[model samples]
Target chain A: MSEEKRIKVLLAKLGVEVHWRGVITVAGMLRDAGMEVVYIGNAFPPEIIETAIQEGVDVIGVSTLGGNHLTLGGELLELAKQKGVKDSMVFVIGGVFPPYDIPKLKDVGFDGIFGPGATQEEIVGFIKDAVSKKLGK
Target chain B: MSEEKTTKQILQEAEEKRKAERVPLYNPEALKQIKEKFDQWYNTKLREEDRKNWFVTPQTILGSEIPRGLLYTPLDVADLDYMQDIGFSGDEPYTRGIHPNMYRGRLFTVRQLAGFGGPEDTNERIKFLLAHGATGINIVFDLPTIQMYDSDDPMARGQVGWCGVAMDTVKDWEILFDGIPIDKISVSLVTHYPTNTAILFAMYLVMAERRGIPWDKLIGTVQNDIIMEEVVRSGAEYLPPKWVFKNQCDNIEFIRKNVPRWNFITYNGYNLREAGTSGVTEMAVAFTNAIDTLKELTGRGHDVDWICERLAFFWDPSMDFFEEVCRLRAARRLWYKIMKHQFNAKSPRSMWMRCHVQTSGISLTREEPLNNIVRAAYEALAAVLGGAQSMHVDSYDEAYSVPTEAAALVSVRTQQIIQAETGVTEVVDPLGGSFYVEWLTNEIEGRILDEIDEMQRLGGIVKVIETGWIHKKIADYAYKEQRKIEEGIIKIAGLNYFRAADVKLPEIDVFRYPEGVEERQRKKLQKIREERDNKEVQARLDELTRAARRGEPIIEYCIECARAMCTEGEMFKALKEAWGTWRPPAYW
Candidate 1:
């Protein structure tokens, strides 16, 4: 758990939807995987991504089960770019996503996509790999 | 000796005669020998390989604390009394079922819960379902309507016409049921709370009156179970608990005299199950709420026999196939005992526990959405086996959003296939005599009774809810269930085990609400406001407010308000002004 190598991730939900079980479970898994995880609670506004930048998180994971993922998830990426933190933070989207929307999300610059039932190992590994790649480790 | 024995003595003799004629399925020595042989075989042959290739963890029966054995025998049900506990179907202590013929005589009502967008949108869906052979209609109100707000209110932004249909006034109700035969088909409105339920009931009466149907001919249920809503669902209480109880009793009293055929209240435990409480807790909490409501009513000089006859129960059938079946059976027996022995109900109909079941919404996974169709089929089968009087199947895409028309049809078809294709409905209580089911029914009944006793010790359901005890219990279970899933202790098919690769995911069309649904609903509400007589509406609202302040029954006044074309928001505002709103105590 060296400070230089430890990964920091921010977990949040988009819009006014209150489906928080997945994100909360993921936050626990990430913490157990030896990463610092900050969870902004359910139905948070997109501006919270700026808080991730202020805290210097290496990855931002947004979970939404509501069908507003297209609008809300896209708004999150747009907000991150506006805040100039889009390049610094790895963006991951998860929960209730249709596979056809994956390409559109990827085109919007989301680095990883984890739909429902994404295992803890895969999520932790994805964050670790993304952090290593970003840091050129 | 020739003199006629008392009825109780005669019944006791009949029960003893039946017991004496029954022979043991297995002798004690034979059972011991079988057990020893099984143990030897397990140790000598299958133990190591079984442990290696399979996860042979101790399996606890779902929703109960008891662990399951490899098999159950007559020994498991040795203590059950056929007459006192597992009576014949349509008899006293009706553990087998309420009806003598059960599904053999008639299939359970296939009530599809449908509503979304605006009134017209939901109306079309209703017509589509009826055309598709749906036997009943369960209307779902949007969040704003459930919260007693007008669609046009600023408080309803982004929420209007999203979750369910938005009905702000009688006009919306008229459009929602325009062509539907209100007198023929059973309609259930999924609305809780006092004011909102009262408004909807009043609107229904007015709608029927306009259609030239008598009040006595109306058949439906308004789910006015406020206690469940306060403890598990939204936890939004517009008035204090006392007023909630008062208003609920008002509806019951009014319906008991006027609308004798309608179910005034449908006590629900389905939401508690969705909130992650165990099956036993769901039953206990639901019945306790019913007992509390009955106490309030009888305390006000209403007869239990009359009120209990019109009450219905709602439950959830989760993936626990046998457990859910046993839970429903146990619920019927437990409720029978409560009504007949505790409350002194005179009629058998008053003791009957009629229930509606919905497949578990929380069990559906967004991953491998098609797999949900299988999950729903099994759950629907369980509900049928459990003897539900009506049932709703969850749509595969429900885990994502409000079900699309295609998904909703699939859900209805799931029930249809189970009813029409499968021969499961040919027998009355087909699983009734199974040793494991009988044993589990008694076990679940005991656990639920214990929970009820604990609730009574804590000063009843209302007290537990007021102190936030029940909410904390539900939250605790929710957390534990999540943790269990994460640790792989409880396996959800596509979720924990058999994980699919992302590339293998299927693409499906999800339902999207039409653009400008909110604006359209607002415009409709504005039009109603402009067209209706303001003076009469205000006068009716004033009368409602006065009735509330006077501590009198408000249902009749609410009817006046609805007839005057006062909107749901206006009626709720008057009541809220008269009786202050309640804020749920933070329990977590």
Candidate 2:
């Protein structure tokens, strides 16, 4: 079999109101795992991530801590669909999100959800596992 | 590094300039007098006379803690030079003051920070402040407008009209400036996170142009303090640093070409200070961030002279009187030294520290709220003595909510009292000759230089920020300060000390969001989308994307996107695709 493709992940803190610590940590972890990664800056909303995904990113991750997660996050997932990559690229949500909000977030079509107190290793392992399972490698 | 050039050369330069009066020794009599006063102040309430102790404690930022005190003495600053190190105002090493005649028979611009609900709401407040002795207006835009999102955007729901005024187009800006004179008053628009600031300024300019207002004659400062935005908010996640830096460069270039007289960014340490940082971190981080931006601007083919003059600083004045004074003095001196020694900035104005000071918003406590008036009064006086070019005193009741009209008026009166009642305006740099003041100045200057060196050793402020150095520092400092207050060690009057029994606080009146503010803003943005040439907006956004791909000036394209009603998030996303996100370091 051909060598397995190392999944590429780009992380961002989507929306205009949130800070970006969690997303950055996750991005660093992804990079350390030999995943080609791109980081969009903070306060970036959905459209930016969707556009970045058009560059052939295998997964798009967003971290948010502000109050507009439901609205901004929903819009981001919608933009992903609008950009025609809802299934092609996995989308993840992370930040001060509570564990209870994971179902709601997942229902909104976010591929994965990581909340407060999540370590970088956990996020990287999950992304790697999810991408690996999807690629059948 | 030679002793000869340090002492002899400095003395010769002083003698050549007819400034040599004596060996630069600390005057024994002055030191004694300063110590006597300091002892008296420290011992006034102490149980024992021997309890009087003086020491320089370093206060930390978000991540560190250093205790500071009320006074600093000549003993603390014995190694500092008056002529060579402190230097003359308007000269190299501007420690004493930035300009030769700082406070030049002119008061710091009394900018009233006012904006809320909508443009009309802001207009009324602007009129109110200007009528009440406010020499200028500092417009604070709401999160919706600041982030370049239309009020109707799902992301902007409920957030509309919460922080400040919401504006979506040229029409909104026109209404905001309705009767305000662009030429007469110095307007400073406070904005951070330019994902939308440049476009907003462009929209304001478009309206100004439509009104036949000369763009060159229109003066105002657009605060593009993007570096400290992450720290100001609730440490949430956002874009990567690379994109933030790119956007700042685009704004610098855009302002250079279109709004030549306008200040593109006012590297804001004050915002972080308001978010609760110590005086040293305030200056260190502000300067560090400014240097990062300056280096990038210069690297992007922008001349230091052209960009430096348009550059400005925004710092906060804390309650610590002497420390605050030293902060300003140290800031000026450090800016001068850095511009000359590091960047080779030759222009006098470029080296001068032209800053705007706002009384600490974070310091205004929600308890014993009226006491905030006292806090603001002292802070404003510190800014005046510190030779701030512009200042805004926080409303006494700002901690609870938006300042009531009475509270805002008291804020204005606080500044007026210092300007008119206090004999401080009669002489410039009134505390210039104080040995204690000079000592504190050197202490702060020394500490700031060390901080800059540390940041430089970390590769730069942007690198340190990426490494989460600044963020961690600020967080640690915040946590320590909170613990101190909680432990009753650093007693806050209302919170810790002076407990009162069922105290009924006075009802403070302030601005309220207008009824249906969200609906009105949403409709306004909708109208903008419907009326604006949809074809033009698309063409502009495409052009903006193309410019970003080419690493061209993205600001003009951003303005075009703004005109097209492309939300702030939309404009930023287009750029994000090209520049990629900022990957914060994993140190935090």
Cα DockQ of the candidate 1 complex: 0.17
- Give interface RMSD, every candidate, in order: 4.5, 8.6
Chain A alone, model 2, TM-score? Answer: 0.84
Query: Which residue ranges in model 2 land beyond 4 Å of their true spot?
Result: A1-137, B1-23, B26-80, B234-237, B503-506, B563-569, B580-588
lDDT of 2 by residue, B414-439 (tens): 87788778878767677876767876
| Predicted structure with the largest TM-score when compared to the true one | 1
Q: Residues B1-588, candidate 1, lDDT per residue (tens digit)? A: 235232223334554666766555457777687678766865787767664543332322135545555566666776555676676899988998999989878889999998888998999999999999999999988766876778777546566776788888877889999999988999998876666788888988888888899999999998887665465544223477778777877888888899988998888888777766788998888887787788878888888997888899998888778888889899998888788656778989999999999998888887778989998899899888888999999999876678888999998899888888998888878898798899888888878888887787777777787787986787667656766766788777777676665435456778877677788988887888899899999999999999999988888988899899998889989998889887556544
Q: Is the docking of candidate 2 incorrect, acceptable, medium or high quality?
A: incorrect
Alpha-carbon TM-score of each model against the true structure = 0.83, 0.75
In terms of lDDT, the poorest run of 10 residues in model 2 chain B is: B1-10
Error of 1 at B515 (Å): 2.8
Angstrom error at residue B154, model 1: 2.1
